[model samples]
Target: MNISHLLRQYEQGHRDFPELNLAGVDLSKVMLISVNLTKSNLMGINFSRGFLTKSNLSQASLNWGDLTYAKMSESQLIETDLTKANLTGAFMVKSVLRSAKLSGANLSYSNLRGANLSDANCCGANLQEINLREANLTGVNFNWANLSKARLSCAVLKQASFFGSNLTDAFIKEADLSHTNLEQVNFQNSRLSYSNLQGANLQGANLQGAKLRYIDLREANLQGANLRDADLEGADLTNAIVDNADFTNATLRDTKVIGTQLKPQTIQKNLSELQLKRNPNYAGSFELLSTSYAVAVFNKDNSLSC
Candidate 1:
């Protein structure tokens, strides 16, 4: 059957539109609404501005395809291979892209609210300014990806690896980031309010000017993290290692510090000085006691306590 006939059949409520080989076809601006292209090979095809709403592209090969500005809302793309595809400004809200390979894909400015991207490989992908609110991104590999200004509010990022990635100014409010590896990631000016970051590795991360109100950092390794001027009000830092961390001018009002100890007397004193300089209303007498105790411990055991 011809492409036009198939299109008419698709628009007529025919869900199963048999295997069509549009592999190298320029299907840009085509109206493929509600079409079922399951397991089809559409690699390198240009589907820019195409209407693919409620379409099924599950297990399809769309690698290196150009889907820029395409309307693919509520589509089923489970296990689809979209590696190196350009999906910038695409509408993918509530789409199912679970376990899909989107490595090196350009998904900037895409609307992926409530999408299922769980276990998807998006390593080195460009997701800047993308909307991923309430998306299932569990175990997603976003290593070295550029996610600047992305809104991932309430997204499930459990076990996600964002090592060496740039998440600058990203809004991740109420997101589940438990056990995630965010080492060497840049979260400058990011908002992660009420997020769960339990057991997450954030070592050497730059969180300057970030707002982390009520965030759970339990057992999280934050060694060498730069948190200058960060707002950590009501945040839980239980058992979090803050060794060599820079919290200059950062707000710790109502912040939980259970099992988190200052490194040394000199360091504590310096931090206290910094804090006092930052906010004159700060009355932290415990830091002085901690310094004294650390000094005594150092003299007695010949080893500095952390």
Candidate 2:
């Protein structure tokens, strides 16, 4: 209750300021538009370059808070703690931060466009180059988060965990990440075009040079996932597990690979060279099994059976 008596009780207008403690307060560059400061303690507070547009700061503790370069547009920060908070280069557009804890938070280069951060914990958060374009991040945990080069295009991230998260060069196009855990997540050079990742786990995920065009990966696990040089053209990977997944020079045009473990002589020699360079009247049915292994079947009206 210092800061020149909270800026003379907000210049005698007196915007709420519920449960104010204002521990270690500095309130750097304060503007505090539409301020409420709900349940505020604001431990180690600085609020660097603060503007705080439409501010509420719900259930705020803000442990070790700095909020570097803060603007906080449309802020609410529900259930906020912001543990170890710095929020470097923060803007936080359309912020809500539902169930926020923000464990070990740094939020490097943050913008957080359309932010909701549903069920957020953001474990071990750094979030380098963060933008989070269409952010909701449902059930977010982000276990060991770094999120290098993060943009998170069209983000929702349902059931998100990101167990050992880095997400190098991440863009995450059309993101959903259904049933997400992403056990050993790295996602090197990630783009993830048209992403859904149904039943996603991605056990040892790396996804080297990933673009993953038309991605879905139904029943997804990808036990030892790498997907080197990955493009995954028209990707589906139905019933996906891919026990020792590597897909070295992955492109897989019109890729599905139903019930995948991927070794019926490497899916009948890569679907017989993608049916002789993209369906030269390729009627699909194959069974050349003298134990040399050739049993290709990819029929979901995209027919290619063997």
- Give the best candidate by TM-score: 1
Window of ten residues with lowest summed lDDT in model 1? 295-304
| Residues 1-306, model 1: lDDT tens digits | 556776788667887864667786777998877778988889998899998999999999999999999999999999999999999999999999999999999999999999999999999999999999999998899998999999999999998889878899999999999988888899999999999999999999999999998899988999999888898777788778888887665666666565566443223335332332112232222132243223111112222222
Segments in model 1 whose C-alpha atoms lie over 4 Å from true places: 11-13, 264-306
Q: Alpha carbon lDDT of residue 107, candidate 2?
A: 89
The true-versus-predicted C-alpha distance at residue 87 of model 2, in Å, is 12
The clash count for each model shown is 0, 5
Q: Which lDDT tens digits does candidate 2 get at residues 34-146?
A: 88988888888898988988889898898789989889987898998988889898998888999889988898888988889898899998998889989898998988889
Q: Which candidate should be chosen as best, given lDDT against the real structure?
A: 1
- TM-score for candidate 2, residues paired by index: 0.39
- All candidates' TM-scores? 0.86, 0.39
